[model samples]
Target: MHSFESDTTPNRQEKEHPGLKLALELGPLLVFFFANLRGEWLVSKFPVLATLGGPLLVATGLFMAATVISLIVSKIVFKHLPVMPFVSGIVVVIFGGLSIWLQDETFIKMKPTIVNTLFGVTLLIGLMFGKSLLGYVFNAAFQLTPEGWQKLTLRWGLFFLFLAVLNEVVWRNFSDATWVNFKVWGTMPITIAFTLAQMPLIMKHSIEQDTSGKP
Candidate 1:
């Protein structure tokens, strides 16, 4: 999880809490996956959940709750919420609410598309104003030159737009199970692969100094 702070220098507590950070970002996702798998059992026990429709609807409610909890925990632990996740959480609540109220899966399915597109547009707009917004998210992880930040920001913006389109294609054309599986198995791996693929660029732009003290 990216800590959402303007301060380039992170405090000691934030620096020491990577495990909590990961939990905040990934725990809700895991809950969503598990809820989808066991939604029938969940409804059987709760009974109130039936009004929300099938397994997907139940999972959507649980997903929304988990997302809110994740954000709360993030704020409490890090004293700030990462902008992207915060925005994502807001969309999750709104769309998830609509999904439950209307008993329609389409709303929940569109959540990713909306969130990704929002981020993609926000990044592109920041770039238009001569801001490398991605740098704020990644400054703690690596130091890159101005040109490097520009290149990386552009790549990520386009990648986000691609993800938005991909989500639309999957959810619109595929079965619910397939969409859920794709959200978990497909997106995570693709993102990791994309991040790894950027290693060459990252290394080229890395500001690290040689141990031998030669520039």
Candidate 2:
């Protein structure tokens, strides 16, 4: 006997467990990272994923598969997609498919550089336009004072630009294997360090839990 009146809040069921969301997002990156490291073994097992016969190709295929799986998991478990992952997934598919079909790793290697730089420039440009676009992008994560949002958005915009530059430098100067390593493991640790350093910033601007941007 289902009631006509809804028991759940509008557009809200159970909140997604944050840890779960993080795992879904990070899992595919790990697969790509590890596959690149032990690419011979992975390609041996799933040869079709490596028709192009390059380590980078194998890693890109795994990354694309993992992105799809992550999105499906999020949709099923959280009942909706998160913004950042959705954006990333779209980029991965487009870039990954291009890399596969072109049989060139450059397309995949350039994905992060393009995505990060675009985000950075777009955020900063939006600010110049008197819009806190970061607010729109991360509204689900935190609510901040007007001043706080401005400062945080500025810092994040710069950070993204730095990441873009670093990616370009690494991929340009290093071999494909080394570049892949940096993309996953190296960038992750750096991001963790930066996130930890942002605790103070988060505290300063934080509102109530309901307003903290976690669903």
Candidate 3:
């Protein structure tokens, strides 16, 4: 009997704690949602927040703070900041700062569109160079062949573009409250479903089983 370890397998020190990872990623967005819902009360309680403007603006400021904190925590607890979340955090700070400074909610609203489009473009460009950047982000959980990584990266790249377009549509046509709700609820479920839908491909090209019999 023999067991094989993948070159891409996460080291013991780098093994991800899924629960913590989810909390770190979603916690800031949750804070943003709740802040929007209780903006008035928050403004009354914290006089400083008033300077930022109405509820949405206040939420944007708080969202930016929470995003920074999440990244810090990820660095401390996980030993390294995740690539995608770190990129997202940078955009959040930039757009969130603009929203607060100029008192324009549109900047913050466009944050998702910008982040998703950035990811989409980066992934597609990486593919053109024969690099599967998605593997770096997801290799901890599973290893895939070169072709598998290429396919998965292409799908995710396109999916991010779709999400960017969807964000533009929702924010442009819907109420602020509705847009916030969709950000928290709608995107998460859709991403989960997309990830689940990729299971067949994942299983088909899993490199772990292929290398298991090696001496």
RMSD to truth, every model:
3.7, 6.0, 5.0
lDDT for 11 in candidate 1 is 60
Q: Write the per-residue lDDT of candidate 3 for residues 117-162, one digit (tens) a residue.
A: 9999999999999999888778877888999999999999999999
C-alpha lDDT (0 to 100) for residue 192 of candidate 2:
80
Backbone clashes counted, model 3: 0
Query: Which pairs clash inside model 1?
Result: none
Looking at model 2, the pairs that clash are none
lDDT tens per residue, model 2, 14-114 = 34376776688789999988888888888788777568558778888888999999888877766766666677788999998999898888889999998
Report model 2's TM-score to 2 decimal places. Answer: 0.82
Per-candidate count of clashing residue pairs (backbone under 3 Å): 0, 0, 0
Q: Rank the candidates by TM-score, best first.
A: 3, 1, 2
Best by lDDT: 3
- In candidate 1, what are the lDDT values of residues 1-215, reduced to their tens digit? 54466433556666899788878888888888888999999999999988878999999989999999988887887788777788889999999999999888999999999998988888899999999998988887689998889899999899999999999999999998889999988998998998899889988887874469776
Residue 127 in model 3: lDDT:
100
The lDDT per prediction is 0.87, 0.79, 0.88
Please give the range of 10 consecutive residues that has the lowest summed lDDT in model 3.
1-10
TM per prediction: 0.87, 0.82, 0.88
